[model samples]
Target: MVVGAGLAGVRSVEALRAHGFGGAITLIGEEPHRPYDRPPLSKAVLLGEIDSTVVDSDLGALAVDHRPGVAAKGLRAGVLETTEGELAYDALVIATGASPIRLRGEGPQHVLRTIDDALGLRALLRQGRRVAVVGAGWIGAEVATAARRAGCEVTVVEAAECPLAAALGPVGAHTAPWYERAGIDLRTGAMVASVDLGGLTLVDGSTVEADVVVTGVGVRPSVDWLAGSGIELDDGVVTDEHLRTALPGVVAVGDCAAWWSRRYGRRLRVEHWDTALNSPEVAAATLLGGPGEGAVYDPVPYFWSEQFGHMVQYAGHHAGARLVMRGDPVGTRWSACWVTDGGTLAAVLAVNLPRDLMQGRRLIEGGQHLDVDRLADPAVALRDC
Candidate 1:
């Protein structure tokens, strides 16, 4: 049984079937709608380029019982409690993704996590409308981009010193100018005191009026239901390299699972679409083959975004790694490589440079040692570096 309906949950079902699991499969979701793609909610869906992001999966042909609008309340030995009633499963896949971190506001603040959120925010983004976005993360930047395209006067208030501070760290400052170039009022080191119907009040006792306010600070793993279920939880549901929990016959995946990464020598809980798409196969294999009997769940984390007239892509983990630039940051196309002290590629960030991103991703996965001087040269290919 699967206890979610997002990309991870749906993919888990497909993986189980692909692994020849002919047992009864049941899928449950808290939302009334069927499983849908979420990355588009911030871009194409908000821009009205697409009406829906529902995934094209036929559960009927797969002979799976899909139950929507049923939320998991609790879990116990051999029993899964839901809003409706209790159910039993021989094995379980927990894919309850994550929830957006909301700020302390009273008025109608917008968020871009669900389809309804994008559609609702899209309605408010009109010509001459005032939009104030909190947090300069990926979601915030994408929303600002879409609002600017819709002719809204957008003001992005970020508490950090630069955009993507949490994701890219100090290196994010290099991309700060892009906000101003796009005509967005990018206010760095600005803290919000409160948010109301009129708009948000800064800590400095100033007001930024707006017709709509969005909080894209970040998201937290959705694991409240597993609190007393004997499943360990730290940043998320703690899992081994096989994505298996402490208890047998159960595993977690997607944003909720903090699986151990043998490559990075750490536990990583990546909240990206790539993880949700690829991790399920390893999870299914582990479930069918038992612990440590099949493919492991280690992977090079990856994500991409389209904002401010640029296609940004990143692969691998960059924490505690040195940044190596391939080209000028001011240029139209460039790539940033993160290398370890041992001269191994740890991660890569490419902007409008697909070849660099593709090649750098391969090098990282292959655990190839890179020459620092060659990697810093734009003329040098990532494979050669």
Candidate 2:
């Protein structure tokens, strides 16, 4: 039984069946709607480019015992306690996903996570009203871009020195002008001290007025259901190298699961879509048989953001490393590589350069070190590194 039908849960069902486990697979989701792709919710769905109906429905054609609209409240060693009732399971996969971090305020604030949230914000966009976005994280930045494209006056408030600086770091976030050039009033070092019925109050006593308020602040794992489970929980569900929790028959995956990383030697939780896709296979493999060998669930984290006609891609983990800017940071096309121990490739951030990311990703996987100039040079194939 899988308690959550988001990306990881859906993929787990397929993986379990593929691994020749023909057992009954019951996939439970708290949302009334079936599982759908979330990455598009902020971009294509917000643009009204996709049909409204399609955005609200399932994309994967898997036949699930999909218990939509049912919420799982708790997890025992071998049973899932839901709003409906308890169900027994030989092997259970927990993919209860994450929810958008609700910004502090009074009247109203929008978060761009679900199709429902997107639809509500889209309605505000169609109204042709001014939009104020607080926080310049990935979602916040994307929504600000969408709001600008929609012809609404957009104002972005960010407390960070630069957009995504904390995650992508200083050099990557320096691309703030892209938003400014797109007619977004990008304000940095601006904290929202208060939010009113009309606008958000900045720390400097100025107010950002808007018809609709949106905050793209971070997200929190939806592990409220596992309150007294006695399984380890920190920022997310803590699992071992095998994706197994402190308790047996209970495994967590997706945004809600934080597992020990062999590469970095720490338990880290990543909220990207790929992590959701990758971790469940390991869980299923271990549950179906043994660990001699399940895949280590160590695919370099990768994610892309589309803004201002540029395709930005990032590969691999970038914690505790010094960033090496290979290409021009101010240039339209460039690559930034984060090297660990101030040397070997740990991750690569590329803008409009898929080849750089592809090559750099390989170097990171191989744990190789080579000429920095050789990899940085556009003429040289980074595969040589």
Each model's RMSD to truth, in Å? 1.2, 2.2
Q: TM-score, each model?
A: 0.98, 0.94
Give the local distance difference test score of model 2: 0.82
Clashing pairs in 2: none
- Candidate 2 lDDT over 332-355, as tens digits, reads 888887778856898888899999
Residue 56, candidate 1: alpha-carbon lDDT: 87
Candidate 2 at 79: error in angstroms?
2.2
For residue 282, model 2's alpha carbon misses the true position, in angstroms, by 1.0
Q: How far is candidate 1 from the true structure (C-alpha RMSD, Å)?
A: 1.2
